[model samples]
Each structure stands twice: as C-alpha cells, then as structure tokens.
Target: MKKKYKERSARFRFWRNIAMFLPGVIVAFLIGFVGSDHPIEFQKLFDRDMLYIGSIILYLIIFGIASTYLFSSRQSYQMMEATEDEDEAYRYESQTRRIYDLATIFKGVMIVPYLLVIFFSCQKLIYEEKLTGILGKYTIPLTFLGLLLLTFGLEHQFRKTFKQIYGKAIPRNSSGAEVRELIMSMMDEAEKQICYEENFDIVFKLSNYVLPISLMAIFLVGITFQTDILLALVVVSLIYVYILVSQYKITKRYYKE
Candidate 1:
C-alpha cells in the first residue's frame, strides 16, 4: 500500500507540476489573440514583447504556487483514502484544509487576464471601429462564463457525491478505501479504453500535423494566389470539418472500446 501510494503520489505531483504552469501558456495564447495597437507612450513603457513575457512569467509564478498547494492537499487526501491509519488521516485532513485555503486565494489569476482581454476587445470595438473583433470579444467572455459555471457544477456534484459516500467521519466502515478502490477501477478501465494509443492511426497523425500546416499554407496561398474571400473560407471550412471528423472518429473508437 505504501509503495503504491508513493508511486501514484509521485506521478500525480509531476503531472500536476506541469499542469500548474499551463494557465500561463493559455493566458499567453489568449493575449496573442487579443492583439491591439497600444498608445505610443504606453508602448514605450512596456513593449508588446515585454507585456507578453511579463504576464506569462507572473501567471506561472502565481499559478505554480497555488497548484503546488492544491496538488499537495490532493496527494495527502489520496494517501488518507488508501490507508486505515487514524493519525495519518488526521494529518492529511489538517494539511489539506490549510493549503486548500491558500490555493483559493490565487484562483482569480487566470480569470483576471481573460477578463482584461474582453475589456480590451470591447474598447477596440467601441473606439477603434473594429467591428470584426466583436465576435471574438463577446464569444470569449460568454464561452468563459459557460465553462466556469460548468466547472463549478461538476465540482459541486463531485463534492456532493464524495460527502454522501465517505461522509465527514474518518475511516467510517472502511468506506473511504472502498470508494478509492472504485475510483481506481474506473480509472483503469478508462485508461485502457479511452486513453488507448491504438485509437490514433496514420490518418489521425497526419491530420493532426497537417491541419495547422495546411491552414498556414492556405493563408499563404490566399495572399499569393489572391483567391476570393468566399473560396478561401470554403477551403478553411473543409479543413476544419476534416479535423473535426478525425476527432469524432477517435471518440467513437473510445466509446466502442
């Protein structure tokens, strides 16, 4: 049990460490999409390159610390669930609650940057006559809001389920262990079926690689060939559909497995 917990905990920490910095990458990408002309003075104070690099670094630092605490709490919880040790369970619960509070403090780190993007988009549309930017601006906020609500709803459901199964009491009738085992069993099945590498074939690989390259090629072609806007859009749409179909096939195979 100890050996298993150590292995699992180590893997969890390593992956969670990687995940901790992912918000920085997403923030950078979103900011790239929200590119706008800055005032000369503002640009002089902090150029576009500096802005992106600084924001990415700040996000990484904040999110990395928060994720470390959250992951630690999670690891401790997982350990508590596996063993029947009362002292260990108490220690884990105490540590979890303390660090969980710390993690929540930095929860807005990702959201704030995204909100800034929407704000900038709106500013551009209103003052700069950027009608085309309206779609991306509104879409980002609406989509982000929907995803936030969905995440909260799913988390609430998981918490409710956990409380119902395990309750507040520690080591109650060994239910924690039983629940852990059940979770592990489900994970094993999922890793075999959904995560199976065989589901991805040559076509999938080629499509994944070629999709971006094709899009870039099409952009170049559109510029050089000077194709009609509608025709270029049609070609892009076709490529998008092909990529979407490829993803659907992978998903279909997962379900079949």
Candidate 2:
C-alpha cells in the first residue's frame, strides 16, 4: 500500500511539474518563432517615461500583499501567545504557518519588480548614452538599495517570528557558521535530512539547468540589444562562480561523509 501510494505521488508530481513547465516553453517558442518575422515593439508598449512609474506601482502592490500576509501571520502568532488552550494554540499555529508560507512566496515575487526596475533603468542609460541627470546617475544604485532594505526588513521579521515560535533568539550579528549552527541545533535528524534534500534539489537544478540557460539568455540579449560584451561576461562570471562554490560545498560535504 505504501509503495503504491509513493508511486502515485511521484506520478502526480511529475505531471504537475510538466504542467508548470510546458506553458513557459510554449510561450518562449511562440515568441521566438513569431518574433523572428514580426518583431515586438516593446519600446512603444513600454515607454521609458512610464516604465519607472509602472515598476513603482507594481512594487507597491507586491509590498502591500506581502505586508498583509506578514501582518496576518503576526496576528496569528499573537493569538497563539494569548491563548492558554492547547487546541486554540494549535489552530493559531497552523494559521500562522499558512500565512507565513504565503509571505514567503512574496520574497521571490518581490524580485520581479526589482529586476524590472533595474532593467528599465539600464535601458534608459544605454539609450541616452549618458546619465541624463541626478536621477539617471543614481537610479540603479537607489533601486539596489531599496531592494536590500526590503529584503533585510522581511528577513528581520521572519527571524523575529521564528524566535518567538521557538523561544530561541538567533543573534542579529551571527556569522554564517554561527547561524548554521543555531539552525541545525533546532532541527531533529529527520528534519535536517529534509532540509538537506530540499537544498540539494535547489543546488542541482541551479547548477544543471538555470546557470546554462541564464548564460545563453544573457548572451542573446546582449547580441540583440548590442549591449557591451563586458556586461554579459560579468554576469557569466558570477554564474560560474556560483556553480563553482556550490560544487565545492557539495564535494566538501560528501568527502566528509
């Protein structure tokens, strides 16, 4: 029975992954095929003047939704804290988890608008052939700074909630080693195995597929836009470094084992 259930689950997951992946593949194919003959007027569709405004609006919307989730999680946590009943606490705990999971999705979603802002800002600079003024000069740097702040704020809230739930504080100034130690200390062997498996999946997918595809896309964009080869090389270099680092970590772990 267990084996049958596992097989069924695996089959379902395979189909689900295919379903999620096929649309992107189809869309890319259609775009490349059609665009070769009938090119898109992206400039007309996405005016430089309005790109920044549109990105800002999108960012605000994402921020609002993320905040709503986080706020709901906090409220659930507070309810759990206030309650003495075991049943009530468990209910609130589950509610908090659901809300936090939604909040976590936004952590990835937030990157889209941030990337759009950077892309549009770079496009503006490239076309103009110079920084138009103070805004142009500082736009990329400011967007980066904003992204950094938003990431830090979200992570801080997440850590605070984690501490509240676990009754253990992870120090703000903890080094990477220290943070890993603290996190590992909180996990059982089974939980640690699950975490390791999930991380390995991420590393495997990134190294095997994401990096190569990203490198190809970067070069294609560079060729299409007539952007500097140096810019593409820099991105390629970063991707290579990530792959190397991941390989080193994996090797070190297996070698020790």
Candidate 3:
C-alpha cells in the first residue's frame, strides 16, 4: 500500500509540475515565433523614465507597509508583555507572529524594487553616455549605498523584534555551524522535519525549473533588447557553478569515508 501511495504521489507531482510549466513554455514559444521576423522594440514598449519613477514609488510603498507591520508587531509584543491574562497574552503573541510574518514578506518584496531602481540608474548612465558627469558617476553607487543602509536598518529592526518575541538572538556575524546550532536549538523534531522538507522543496524547484526558466528568460531578454549576451552568459555560468559546487560539497559530506 505504501509503495502504491508513493507511486501515486510521484505521478501527481509529475503532472502538477507539467501543468505549472506548460504556460511558460507556450508563452516562450509564441514570443519566439512572433518575434522571429521582426525584432521587438523594448524601448518603445517600456518607458525607462516611467519604470525608474515607478520603482521608486513601489519601494517607498513597500517600505511603508513593512514599517507598519513591524510597528504593529512591536505593539502586540508590548501588549503581550503587559497582559495579566494568560489567554490574552497568547492571543497577542499569535498576533505578533502574524504581523512579523507580514513584515518579513514585505522586507523581501522591497528587494525587487530596490534592484529595479539600481538597474535603471545604471541604464541611464550607460545609455546617455553620462559616465563622466558628477550625477552619472555617483548615481548608481550612491543609490546602492543608500538603499543598502535602509535595507540593513530594516533587517536590524526585524531581528531585534524577533529576539524580543522569541528570546533567540541570531548573531549578526555567526558562522554556518553556529547559525545551524542556533536554529536547531529553537526547533523541535517536528518543526525541524518540516524545515528540512520545505528546504528540499525549494532546492528541488530551483534546480528543476527556476534556473532553467531564468536562463531562457535572460536569453530572450538579451535577444529582444539587443543587449550584450555576455551578461546573460555570465549569470547563467555563475548559477551553474553554484549548483555544481553545492552538489559536490553535499556529496562529499554525505559520502565521506
């Protein structure tokens, strides 16, 4: 029965993956077919100025939302501390966790716009040939430094609030072994199993689908924009190197004599 169940589950997963990836494959084929004769004008399709402005606005909005969530989490934590009723305290604790989760999500969301902002900034310098001017010379680097500071500030607050709630201090500069030990100390067997399964799923998806899709998308983008294919090749090469190195290390560790 167990063997039959495993076979059924594997079949289901195979079909599910096909269903998920089919649309993307179809879209890529259609784009290639349609654009084969006529090259797509990306500049006409997308306004660089609008994209730059939109990215900044989106970043600000994500920052505000994440800040609000962090504030609410901190407030809930305070309420949890002050509450005399055990049930009320537990409710506040749950609320705090939920709010903190949202904050964590927005923190990740912020990165997309942050990266877009930097990309557009660099694009401006490259396209305009303004590399020698003070504005162009400092724009990308300054934006990077400023945004990095903001990101680090948000991260620090998130970690501080997390420690307040969980009483687990995640060291700022901990080694891999130390971080792993801290994480294991915080989880029971069930939680650890769930974490392991989730991590496996993430790695499996990345290896099987995400990296391949990304390479294809990057190639398409480079073709469409008439950009340097070297950038796409470099990115793909780095991803392959990372995957190979990770696999080698994992094999070495598990198959050690």
User: Each model's TM-score, in the order given?
Assistant: 0.33, 0.61, 0.70
Q: Rank the candidates by lDDT, best first.
A: 3, 2, 1
- Please estimate how well model 1 matches the true structure, expressed as its whole-model Cα lDDT: 0.55
Best by lDDT: 3
Candidate 2 residue pairs in clash (backbone atoms < 3 Å): none
Positional deviation of residue 242's Cα in model 1 after best superposition, in angstroms:
59
Which pairs of residues have clashing backbones in candidate 1? none
**What's model 2's lDDT at 131?**
59
lDDT of 2 by residue, 1-38 (tens): 11333446888989987886675577566656656544
lDDT for each residue of candidate 1 in 39-89, tens digit (9 for 90 to 100): 223334544434533544555566566667666657666776787889988
1 or 3: which has the higher lDDT? Answer: 3
Per-residue error for 68 in candidate 3, Å, reads 2.0
**Strongest candidate by TM-score:** 3
Superposed model 3: Cα runs more than 4 Å off: 1-38, 41-44, 125-149, 168-181, 221-227, 252-257
